[model samples]
Target: MLLSLRGVSKSFGAVHALQDVDLDVLAGKVTALVGDNGAGKSTLVKTVAGTWQPTSGEIFWKDQRTSIRTPRDADALGIATVYQDLALCDNLDIVQNMFLGHERLRFRLLDENAMERAARGTLAELSVTTVRSVRQLVASLSGGQRQSVAVARAVMRDAQLVIMDEPTAALGVSQTAQVLALIRTLADRGIGVLLISHNLNDVFSVADRIAVLYLGRLVHSGDVAGYTPQRVVEIITTGTLATAAT
Candidate 1:
C-alpha cells in the first residue's frame, strides 16, 4: 500500500468524526472514498492530508508507520490534496499558478522560462490538450481545464499521492469525462490517487478500488467490480448490505 490509515479516529470534543477507520491506497491505482453527508469522508480526507491531526491513529506512508501533524509534513511525504474549489488564483496564468508559492528562481527573480517549460511539460504528461497556451489566465479556462491545471500543478510538484475531493462535481458530461480520463492517466503514470466523490458513476468509471465510509466508520473496502450502484447506496445509507464483503 502506498498510503494506509490504521485504526484512525478523529474527534471534535465529544463528536467523533471518525472512529476506528482503516483504508489503503495503492500505487498506480485510484481508490474512491464515498459516503453520504456527515459520514466522515471529509474528516478522513483532512486527517490524511494533515489539515487535521487524528485524535488517535497511525498513518502509514509507503508501508512505514508515520504521523501527519501538518500540511507541510504531508507535502514532505509527497501527498497533495486537491479540494473541489481547486484553490487556484483566478488572476494568475497557468504557469504562474502551477508554481505559485514554490516558484523557481535563477537569481533573485522569478524563472519564468523554466517555470513555463515545466508547467507545459507537466500538462503534456497528463495528456491535457484543452488549453491553447500556458500563458492563458485561469479565469478564461473551462471547468475541466481548470481542474486539469490544478492536477497538473500537483504532478509538477512531484506529488506521489494525490487526494482529490469531488473533482468533477460542477462539470458537464464532456468535462466530467475529460477529468475522469485525466485521473486514469494519473494512475497510469504510477501515482496513487484517492478520489473522494459522491457520484457513483464517476467513482466506478475511474476507480480500481472502492472504500465506503458510513457514520464515522469504514463499512466496506474492496474492488469496484464487487459492488453495484444500488449496493453502494445501501451500504452508504444503512452501514451494511447483504452483499457487503465487510
Candidate 2:
C-alpha cells in the first residue's frame, strides 16, 4: 500500500468527526471515499493530508509508521492534496502557478524557462491539450483545464499519493468527463488516488474500491464490483450492509 490509515480517530470540541477509520490506497488504484454530510469524509481526508492530526491511531506510508504533523510534511513525503477550491492563483500563468511555492532556481535566479518546459511536459504526459499555452492566465482557462493544471502540478512534484476532494463537483458533463479521464490516467501511472465525491455515478465509473463513512465511523469497504448502488446507499444511511441481502 502506498498509504494506509489504521484505527484513526479525531474529534472537534463536542463533536466526533472520525472514529477508528481505516483506509488503504494502493498503487495504480482509485479508492473512493463517500458519505453523506457530516459523515467524516472531510475529517479523514484532512487527517491524511496532515491538516489535522488524528487524536488516536496511526498512519503508515509504504508500510512504515509515520507522523504527518504538518501540510509541508505531507508534501515532502510525496502526498499531495487537491481541495475543492484547487488553491490556484487566478492571476498567475500556468507554469508560474504550478511551481508557485517550490520554484526551481539556478544560482539565485528563478528558472522560468525550465519551469515552463516542465509544466508543458507534465500536461502533455496527462494528455491535457485544451489550454492553448502554458503562459495563459489561470483565470482564462475553463474549469476542466484548471483541474488538469492542479493535478499536473501535484504529479509533477513526484506525488505518490494524491487526495482529491470533489474533483468533478459543479462541473458540466463534458468538463466532468475530462477530469475523470485525467484521474484514470493518474491511476494508470501507478499513483495511488484517494477520491472524495458525492456522485455515485462518478465513483462507479473510476473507483476500484469504495469506502463509506457514517457518523464518523467507517461502515463499509469493498470492491466496487461487489456492491450495488442500492446497497451502498443503505450503508451510507444506516451504517450497515444488511440491505445487500435483499
Q: How many backbone clashes does candidate 1 have?
A: 0
* Residue-by-residue lDDT tens digits, candidate 1, 99-144: 9999999997999999999999899989998899999999999999
- Best-fitting candidate, measured by lDDT? 1
Pull out the clashing pairs in model 1.
Answer: none
Question: lDDT values of the candidates?
Answer: 0.94, 0.93
Cα deviation of 172, candidate 1, in Å:
0.4
**How accurate locally is residue 68 in candidate 1, as Cα lDDT from 0 to 100?**
90
Candidate 1: lDDT over CA atoms? Answer: 0.94
Q: When superposed on Cα atoms, how far off is each prediction in RMSD?
A: 1.2, 1.1
Prediction-by-prediction clash tally: 0, 0
